[model samples]
Target: MFFFKKFFKKKKQPVDSQQTTDRQSVQSVSKIDKIGKGKSQTSRGLIKSNKLFMAWNKNAEEKKQRQKSGLVADSYLKQISPKKGFTFHSDYFEVGDGVAQILTIVPTKNADRQLPPFWVTRMLPRGLGQNVTARLIQPISTKTEKWTKDNEVKADAAVRQAYGERKVNDPSNQDIAFQVQDMHQINEDLRGGQYHGSEYKILLKAPDVETLDSAREQYKLRLKNNFRGLTVEVFEGQQKDDFENLLKSADAQIGHEKKMYTSQELAGGYYLMSKGIDDITGKYVGVSEGDFNNPAMLMDVDDWSRNIVVASKFGPRTGSYSTEVFGDHLRSISLWGVKIAEDAMIQNHRVVHFILNNTDIEDIGKRKIGADLSKHTSNINMGKGAINPFEAFGREEDKLNVYPTLTEKLRLMFKEMSPSLNDVDLNKYFTQLLKEFMEDKGLWKPNAKENIDTISLVGLPHNEYPLLSDFSLYLSTIFTIYQKQGNQQAIKSLEKIQGVVDRMKEENGDIFDKHTSSVVDNAQTIPQVIYDFASISERGRGIAMAQFINTLGYATQNLHRGDVVIIHGVDQLAPEVKEFVKDNLQKLTRRDVRIAYLYDNVMSAINDKDFNDLTSADYTLFSAMSSDELEAYKETMKATIPSALENSLISKDDLLYYLSRDREKVLFKLDLIL
Candidate 1:
């Protein structure tokens, strides 16, 4: 059935059919190219399929139309082709988006005589690129002639008013009593009047414009009353540069931006918002903004949103008063003390976050970005008026009493605090203290023995007890003790104190002599001496006391010569044994002694010298005897040569020779005894 199925199956299609299918596909491609003006070769098939080409063409046409109409939206543009003056434009449209294009025209021909014209332009909507032209206008020329005529009438009016008031309110009777003609005559007389009294002649002489003008008016009034022939030559000064003065006043006013808020005004305003103005035309063009909301804003303004906006606007320019409009968007936010203290922790974190996010702050030139952020954080956390726990001790008295400033204190605190040890490391504290002692207090000379001693006294104990190192009271007590008796005793006393510390140098030459040792080189010799004294005071005391007691035991035995007081072992002696013996004995027969044969074994191993030495009455060696030997010795009071010698006081060499003389005979006796 499988063979029949394989035979009946249709054969595969021929290569000619496949070639014909390929040719047909090629023909279809050629037909498509011909239909589209042969643009198919230039066009991407995939791009066409996705309709990206159509979109591109549509955008291209729109951009071309926009360019031709000069209506590119929200983009700054300048007419580069016609470079006569800058066509200023701005692209700012939305709440926070704007671009101002400024063109500076520098007069190359005459830099000093001709001022450069500044052109500024702005764009509004996102797609509008309309260029607006703005030109700097020169100030009007200063001229006295223009000022004189302009103010003449006002001056005349002022002169008439002054005269009328003076005449009406005349305090002197002579001023009131004088006729108008007489007043004019007096005015004329004063201008070129002859001296009547020689002594008082012309003490001061100057024409009072008000008085002269007033006299002229009074003279005119007198003439109307038929008082004629009253001729007066009034000297009138040229009209002052009143117009120029007016212009000057106007210029001064224009040059300066009036302060919007005084202290009282600021208090009442409830909110403050400041904006930077264009210098050329005093108009609000830019607002300063801070990256972080200022804490101060909450206290300054009652309305939270308004206060935030005002703070955001003005805080960035807190330290700056520049003609340039661009400044930090967020600078500072000042809050009331209570509010600030309450929110200090959160605000500090906010400031840190703001600084971290601000690209402009990161781009600052003088300080690293991380460093600036750290400084900002520190300011927010520990700055003046900040309620930070780390700075809680910064009261006025503490400030005065603290030898170091706050910065130094903080530095020392940071250096001494150890997160690893779960406590502050006092080694650093003592090191800082030693440094301060030398530098600030001038207590120690460089490399002086006293300085070294002081350091050792302070450093070693601090190493042992790090917790106590930073305690000023503890340090004071130690210093007091050191100052009174010097560091030697303190150093000696500290040797017994135990704590974790770096390995110390071995002082005595015995153990450390074998290795190439840093202790021998770096360790101070004086400290070693103090350590030796301390060691003697501690360990040596016990040994000495035991020796004293042993000495007393031997002395007691000597006093009762017939009686034996047996010490089983040298190792078993008490600390005071030697001292006991020295205090009581007239003389000790042997400097050293050992005891033997306790508990069926030798209590102490004694060499021939020591054994023979004990034969003297001052010392005794006790040994257990076998029951049989004891019985035999009790019956026979025989004294053999060896036994007699063993019992008697003999030279060490003589005792050795006697014991060695007949080893085999001794062995036979030892075997019989066993």
Candidate 2:
């Protein structure tokens, strides 16, 4: 009966045909309308309807489940898994498209200690399943040197060789043999040496416990046999401390030796200049051959070579040393003497004088007395216009006093007599004085006084005599020729010696009254003698005056007259000063030296201003920049232009422009331009 029902019964009877036809007609009309309007069926609409039905069914199921579980229909699980086989509880899948699944996995026993933390939802395959079910076994300490049959034979040979036929009784030999038997049980120790010998020690470290035990035994054996002669010292750690101590000791020894040798060499000493003074027959002296061998000495070549030896020859007088004589000579030695003295002073020594006059006293007295004073006294005693001897000597003294009454006159006489008194002459004069003084012992005899007086008159060495002599000869020759020619003009022009006297007065400011007055009087009178002998022009006379002015050290001041000198006529002036003088030569010709002076003053001002402006501008520019920037600017400027020099003048603006341009260009090249 159930089968018949299943086969024959219609599923359900259709509704009225007219009504269904009406419904189909309605659907067809709707489709036709939709097609006519270009509108088509939307999958979104179907999906929305399907989604609604599914959502409703899911809600119903969720409600049923909630009824059972007492949870809300819109719970988190329901939202995540809406359908069967897609439930959040079964698979636990992440719901959102972009959500990442994070699993916190705790470590388990049997996991490899080296493995990183694991993740249940891993990005990569878990490697080898965490190395589980495996255990690390402690390694057995095997014999480091395996004793194979052949190895054993070699070891036996080594032991025999090292033990040197080991005796059974000697304990040391037995110990050494035992050490040799275990060939691999030896350690190497290397050390450094002092002097010529080598001391060896070594350091070793073990990587494992087995290696550590083996190394210990080996070290013991090595100390017994291989290093038998060496002292075995154990070092447990770093050897840097020992090495540093050794290096310090070595350095100390080396420094000590170096210091010792240096001190020794310093103390040994060496010559600084030439070896001085071979003999002490006289006094210690420093003499130059030039002075002693001067041509004016009139001595034979051999004598002249030894002529002016300035020995520390001592006279009978106390403090009568050659140094004093030399010093006096150095001082009064004329212009050349003054120069030499100045040079000596610069070399750090002072000079004094001890001059010995060798003039004939009787001749000097006779010359003073004019005609024979002895004959005059004899005649007076014979009753021929009687004159007292005292009066005669008095007249002689007065006459002697009349000729250039000044110390310079006495100095001049000594200078003239200098060349005559060489070492031999001085020695002879001293010997004579000693003889005279000895004869009149304890009584100051007048003759003894004379002898001592002659020796006492020490002055500047006559060493500079030639210069004075040449000067005198030149003047005398000029005077003699002029007088013979009677050329008053030449004489007058050349004879203006007062110029020199005035210059001397200007320089010294009347320090020596007698000398100054005598020189001035002589100068005034000599021009008359020259004028009578030669006739010279005004320009010649001016040149002579200029020369005289130079001799008195006032050439520059006097010729320029404290104004512009128009040094165009003088080649000796500095070129720059000369140029200034020449540039204003026309003004000088206008007899208005003030114009030249003004030009000089203006030039000085301009130069000073130029220098100041350039310095200030440079300082400003340099100070404005850092050291590196200043250096860079200088390099750039140097590369762009020629060197700046004193002779070259550039306007301040132009220089600044150059410097600025260079700075800008360099900065721009370095990308530092602001």
Candidate 3:
């Protein structure tokens, strides 16, 4: 899903019910009903051709439908999809007929189904700032009108506790700083008067005078009676004014609203704009763009706190690094240096300075840094560890539903296919072939010899860049295959090379991963991984490719038959690789994956003979770097790698001298190929 602040942009592309989606994804919404009568007001505009999928937008005809359906003006709420993505197994409540909202049942563990208390928070008119909401429920039983109010108190408390415990936030600060403007513009754009803040009392409270006085104390301390204005005499029934008042409030009681997905949000790494609150300095503040670590306003906040005047605490900023950044889509890659001013800010990501350029480590290793000059630096040691621990994000691979047994079975079939596994003397050759078989399962990589460890691959004489590291596992299988599978010269050359290691093979040295060995130990290798791969029915291949190809992990439940999967970067791949991907992807449909031939990089380079087939379904490459980007990347590497080395063990002169005298080139800038 993509996030854009412009609400109107969503209208350009309504959801198509025919879109292929597994049963659970709410995104695969098939039908939408209007909140009121007018069967003709169904989602007729949503049934558009799939050609628009190229842009991958989430547009809707919600406003036009809202007008045509002539539903109550307040029925559509704010028309903003909640931040939390869709979810299933969550209870939803119906209102009258066609509309129902996703319900948030609380006091979760001890929830009493008989009296299960659920809460719903709807978006309010953007202009109001105070607590402008009231909870109203149409009871299904003799649950007293008082129960609705009491339920709301409990519900509101539970919601607050839930937010604190989950660290989830809404657009509170954004509402304060930008609401009035958003309200005015959205009001005109949506062409409705019900959306006006005065018409809705979303933040007003129906408290008695005494209740109002009690809540006003805190605001007095805040030097503003903000909460008091939210109180209003309780409105007992659902009147037109009541509906308008509550619609403008800060919260809502779930009623009817189908075709909606809501849940508590789970963005942990960085939180920029949570909400805006009055600072002791007596000004509203919420930052939108800056490093999460130290924005320009941080010092101003610090200085104010230290002085005798106003003291303000910037609750949090408006942007997030884990979730967002300014201008969007900065894809390639670069290394940046970090300096932490305070230990408390350790986890914050700061993209500030470029410290090194020549990123060519081969050149750096030749000359040593200080005492460590005693040995060459290894990528294993210098390679940065994997980024943040994503477990909290619900992406644990172990927990990911993978087909471990079938995956192993497929591995075993690979071994039985190798020609030399029959003879005891071929045991050595069998083991070597086993490794090749497994490596071949990683289709995203080119069909060539590759070390299981990627750093080692780069250490080879000629290594491809962009690393192709993400999907390496997808193309591999059981027994390692011959360098050029089924080629006689390559096979003899392989045996001849292993023949020299014969004496060593006599000793027991096995390289199978525990899980891999268990499956292959059972026998029956496939004729060859590629042949087996190609021989599968297009139906089965589509299923396997979709299921197995994931950045999350190798193990996953097989995709159901007919499920489509898209292979990216296909057009830009080397000729042979492109053909293999295309041959395998024929059975899938466009809905499975977008077969784009251009990405951020160059899309049409005159240099490649293969550029003629820019529309080939075989390639995933959307675009390649332009001459300028490629040239800049190359130029940056030339300087950065050298600067990085200057700070390393050896001096630049020593590295150049060593490169000029001993090595053909001390370091080949890998990205130089881009």
State the lDDT of candidate 3 residue by residue for 246-319, as single tens digits: 33322232232111111111111123331222224321112212111211211111111100110001110122
- lDDT per residue for candidate 2 within 551-583, as digits (tens), equals 121111111211222110121222222333233
**Better by lDDT, candidate 3 or 1:** 1
Each prediction's TM-score against the native? 0.15, 0.14, 0.18
lDDT (Cα atoms) of all candidates against the true structure: 0.24, 0.25, 0.24
For model 3, what is the C-alpha lDDT against the true structure?
0.24
Question: What TM-score does structure 1 among the candidates reach?
Answer: 0.15
Candidate 3: residue 515 Cα off by (Å) = 3.5
**Against the correct fold, how does model 2 do in TM-score?**
0.14
Ranking by TM-score: 3, 1, 2
lDDT of 1 by residue, 156-220 (tens): 45445555667544664343333333333323433422211000000111133243234334433
Best by TM-score: 3
